[model samples]
Target: MDLFGCMNVKGRSGTKSQSVKFFILGEEFNDDAKKVEVYKKSIDLIKHGSPRGVITPIFVTYCSRFSRMIVCYPYFDESLSDWLKRYKGGSSNLPYEIRIMIRNLLAAIEHQDINRLEDISPIVCVKSKRDNTMEVKVILLPVQSEQSSKAKWRTSFSSLLRKNMHQTWLEDKDFEAFLLMLESNEYTLENLMGHPVLQDGDSNGRLILDCFRETLTPAQHKELEEKLNVQKYDGGDWRLRLQGKTPLENMSKRSTAYPGHDFLWFARKTVAHFNENDAKFKNATVNRVPAANVIKDLYPGFISDLYKLSLEPQYLNRALG
Candidate 1:
């Protein structure tokens, strides 16, 4: 079972949702006993039910079929992607100050590590949104080698943890990045003008490298940033101004985000239990959430269900193994 898509979510009890729609689903490829075991293991991994929903793995369910897991996501007005396209990608382009604003927003994510601060990978897919710009969420999707019906995208931790677990986790890498992002003091890319977001219209990505050399620490900037500036990938258009390797692609301008779907990877990691648990099957990963929280919107219950199914460790382990 896998996430089908998002839907119109409604109502919640206090902070709890009344009817949350999750798209993650389950499938019939493995033994029932094995499936149950993996499901239980993952549930044990999750300790807290995120309050602010910042670095927490949201686990509310909307109801799903036997084949998959169900989740409930909030419905926001728009996505960060669309917002960027409209506000930044459009003719207006992003102002240097605005870029700082956005970069600051993304930088904030580096600090929060949900599990292990050192272990947290980059936040995955991002989308555009409306309403409150500050509300924009940097979606963290799962990283996986294969796709399946049980949690088409991936599964949920809430489902796994809900069953039974004695231990409790106070902080994780996701929370680490979340805190860093939230507490970021280095707003400047080089302290000169921040990370050189507003590039010359004719320039490639490399120019940013020089800026980083002056601004960011050796660790803050990635090798890809420099390499990409000099090279072009399958989908990248060197001629046209780039937007830091399409939201989904990895280090390549030409490739699409996450290769499968824009937000799929983000959904997978943040919500996926099996994928994250399996070190062997690494999910497509990005560096971190954009300072702007790029993507924001309610994920459909169908998609939530898929995540539940995907989180089932036994099924996913078999697939990955």
Candidate 2:
């Protein structure tokens, strides 16, 4: 019989490990049957989850009627083309509000180093079905070319050790750039290890090139710093400007900070990550955590407090309090 579903059975040793074989929907499979891996990637990514970003609901998981794994995604509510059509064929003299939204979206994409314009689309504006406030959203899809995804996005020591593996196709320079991204804390290394890959791994890995595309040569770094008189903004200054809205403010900060002398520290780190040798890259990567930690670190009791702090009376009270 064909396999339909399975469940994990823990061991009696009190430690959590799969020790019992799972039947397909409580039915046994033939001894010589071939098992298929379905939604292998989507399943793994759902487990690892994504980082804090301007994007949301990157993808969702579902099981099809036939009991096969399926990957589902939110529909693109509105494309850039749809918005431009409203202005009579992308002509100038666009509405001021629409212009600002477009500007902010472009800034976000640039800060994220996205290439294709289609990757971004405006999500439909809607009332918070629950709270009744206007909300805006956008989508930034990641690159998914087979060669790029396998060679540059995901890799492990075992994969690297394999002869004539997919990763072997990467050019020496591209490979070096990939390793540099991992070393610099720009890309978390934990995802490259065993178990479920990072939910945002492919996109983040793809963007690493954008982050490392140009390194600040010493002369360039010095010249920029001299121009700025070596000034800098700390968390306090950012907090005031951001007004406690960390996520929204961080995106703006990333865009304006780039190509500025005061942000040389970020640039220098990129240079350091790019120049590190393989040994150091691997060593430093060992201590890193995935991007999901960014959310948890910001709100320790997030899951438990989400509804309590977000829903009706609580949210209203806190805001008015």
Candidate 3:
């Protein structure tokens, strides 16, 4: 099918810092040539040069020798930022269409992860030319290549994770479980946090964690193998594709199984920590609005920590005993 898009050029664009210009073949395009090449290679590497379980946007280079480049996608009625601003609660309770876009985007990411390809672009939402539909499209843009070392990339990854408050849905226990899953990949719980506990002052340790985080497990590693295969990429609903595919439920079970524990003991500790912090703020002489604001700010981190603790059997066993 011939994919088409408009040239009206409406709405806000990404910042200059987040964008780059590229020279493809002999023509200039406003993107990175390397990213375009990588994306082209990814397309060729997939099952049929067109992956299923996701709708990848078509990139049209307007020349035999890649002289010009334009990403052909349907016109999106709203940017994710604008949509989130209008919708109040962000991705937590996104409208159906937007949710589909985000899900598809993540599915694309999963495809890249599954293929073990690096330097792929995150998906963007756009209005489709095919029946004016809103869809997620992956645009190949150059990522900053200055982070040449594993440590540098790991630091960047953790910092990004910490800033994305929406990831609170993972919960602290789930976060830790996910970490454990990644352990076979050589990542530790600390690799995902900006300022991991205890080892805060050790740059060398952070570097080591970063290097570990990028290490991929052998394909023969069964446990890690299963989690990485969570979605089958059969071109179905992204949510359905992820349902029960991984052993996420197993993690939840392990998290709640501390000796003589009914409820997850570590989960309770996280709640206590939040309450304690809130109490401290309330008792302070600060204005009620600011105090409340502070609690709100701190609450998500506590939740994240609580989720992380779920993966720590040693800590749970020690504390519950």
Candidate 4:
């Protein structure tokens, strides 16, 4: 398939945008019957099965004069290949840009999964508007069967990532972890947002929430905020909050055996101290729990203190004690 830019093309209602219009020219079919059948199928699929972030051609027809199938798509700011070239050396917003690209690609794959469309090879395009916002436009084509395997999809996405990001970006630990998750097909939009590298900061030093607020709709932003309940503390750590309490507070209150005893109190203090001063503990607590041995190695003294405190009168007299 070949994409062509059309400028000043008026609509059937005699309307047109000031910007250039773009359309795709598909390879010629065997005959008019084949062309008509493909065109109708494309239209019907788009009407009933089109997924968000995937772009379907606006108009599809057999151009008798040119004897080719023309698929007219909506206007897009630029092709992904061109955009990658423009930012070849990397940019301040490169990480965020790549995030958006991956997100859209996944969305396209989700579309394919839901509709059971096989052998799809996406022609990725982008729309970077003046407001510093971007939209990814995935044009799905039946060019290859590589999409059937998660491994192949990872390879394809990694190639695209290599085009837009620098070696340093790819080498980042969080990025590597993200790629691992992608390879395992364990990634989702929510997981992507909370991925350490993305949460760290964009190239321009903007935080994840700021990036999300700029890109997501108000409702979506609100939903995410409620779901994560995460806030960046002054110490530069993103902490998850429950209700109006910090993680330590929530954990402290969760102890059934020593609810209001000195054991729970010391545990809470230990958690708070570890959260603030211990790098390993902080990293472990960011989005998940550390292994038992890891916790023991890091806080043997604290664990001992809690154990000793648990034998105290207050803890021993507790209902579950």
Candidate 5:
């Protein structure tokens, strides 16, 4: 029989653990002997499989009363869904959080492909730990009787990305391109890992803000300091400018003290040069401008440019030799 549910368990060491939540394969078998056989095969596959980013079951037992297999895994701090919910309004670590998720998820999928564990749905079982550093855990569930094909797994993975990720961290173009490649089914796992979007570097908006600050004229800097009361442009200020909003207007004291109309005009003009040339700037007059919300959306080509810059001989020699 194909069935799945969640249950809390107590470990031998006295720590509480969670049972693996199974993904139903829509296959049903009435025979007890056949169910036992399927359970054994699933256990063996997990026992021998060495899949990075996949959690190995700590214990497995056949319950005669329930006529079901109980698979318990080590305690996970939280599910991926819960973790993402905490940051729905957005956070500074969102880029790092997303990058870690993508890396582990891809690794788990690669492992599944290698071990022929296509029936194991890692995407459904994603978890995370937040002790010292953020980490993603892909809990591998028990194998199903009628295993899902590799194509099915790919389609499922792609659908999950499209559903959950498009509105979040990644830029639209980057995410769409990656999704296209994923759905293509031609690229190897290694090739996908090497893709520019997957490659890690820096996503710090402060760096880009500093670059913008450098382009500011001496008079413009003075105006920003005196009128807007902005000494240095931080990430928050940069974000407001990107959204075609003024930082001074958002602050209670500044909003009251400064002339709202005049300050907003000055602020817009101050950032006009950078916004027009370097960043994606929306018109403040527009009722709803679909602008880049996260730092990942700003300068989508910057990360790739940084990668190319690193490959240059001057940078390579300085860093390596």
Candidate 6:
């Protein structure tokens, strides 16, 4: 149940610029006062805080307030960086392995009230040291706060969808917020990138978008409400308890349907996975990657004018039509 000095620290760590983090050993937390609270919360999150079968300690703590201040978790496996490195660039293929882990982690993030989960990128999850035998255990760290919440939300959420790359079941409006953020970018798709897309970008325009994205149809929102009712706080699999109301599930069917024409816009990314590797490395792919338009599957006529605005950098002024 306890992993003593089980520390394997790596990555861009410990700096004023470094986002908030907790060490696996006594070093897990720096703030003495909040450490206890964080550890307790973490324990609650683990469902099985004892860390008996985890590959890494879910966390380290003592009943003593001092012990509670410290926490520990396994090293992050298949990090966003790892994903990019393995794929050679931006070609994120959603294999089953990544899918299960990612689904679990996003679910974890949905449950996390921590504001810091926003800044991090290329989302990842790790098995627990205590019981590699149990269901997957993931640790999502803090994201940078200084960046505009909108930008951070855009990057993180898009990165999740891009990595998962699910087809056929988007439910449209369900994930519109993840793609075209509501608080900031809804009025103009240009501002659709961060959490709460912002409350007041263009009041009238936002009012319309808010009506669409947040105001899910009664049936759609009803399922979420129903599942949330059976929440069992015993640290069991959150997916099991939430009755399928996952972070991804919040997406709803958009009342505003796009034009009927379907087109695959992307041509492959700079960073794709190695699922089709051969000879010595039989896990990499060599296929045509394609564009991920701001909106896809639009009516042919409307598709030409799909997105006049670009996100700058790699997509700068490139004709989307």
Ranking by lDDT: 5, 4, 3, 6, 2, 1
Off by over 4 Å in 5: 1-30, 64-67, 89-94, 113-130, 145-150, 202-297, 301-321
Q: TM-score for model 4? A: 0.51
Tens digits of lDDT, candidate 1, 6-62? 564434545543322243534442445544543443343235332232322244332
- Writing each residue's lDDT as its tens digit, candidate 2 over 1-321 gives 122233344558868643221112211211113122223333443454432223332232233344432223333233334443443423111233332333344345334432233232323332344775433344332222233222232232223212221232232222333333333433333322211111232233222222222454555435434432322323233224334544324443554555444233333333244335354442443223322222222222221122122223533343334
Candidate 3, TM-score vs. the true structure? Answer: 0.34
TM-score of each: 0.29, 0.23, 0.34, 0.51, 0.51, 0.32
- The weakest ten consecutive residues by lDDT in model 5 span 285-294
Q: Write the per-residue lDDT of candidate 3 for residues 70-133, one digit (tens) a residue.
A: 4443333433444434544432212445334433433444344322123223333565557876
Top-lDDT structure, candidate number? 5
Indicate whether candidate 1 or candidate 6 has the larger lDDT: 6
RMSD of 5: 12.1
Q: Which sections of candidate 2 miss by over 4 Å?
A: 1-53, 66-80, 83-91, 110-115, 118-137, 146-321
- RMSD in Å for model 1: 21.5
Please give the RMSD to the true structure for each candidate, in Å: 21.5, 21.9, 17.7, 14.4, 12.1, 19.6
Q: Model 6, residue 45: what's the lDDT?
A: 54
Q: After superposition, how far is residue 285 of candidate 6 from its true place, in Å?
A: 20
Model 6 clash count equals 55
Evaluated at residue 191, the lDDT of candidate 2 is 23
lDDT at 15 for candidate 2? 80
lDDT against the true structure, each candidate: 0.30, 0.31, 0.34, 0.46, 0.46, 0.32
Minimum summed lDDT over a 10-residue window in model 6 is located at 261-270
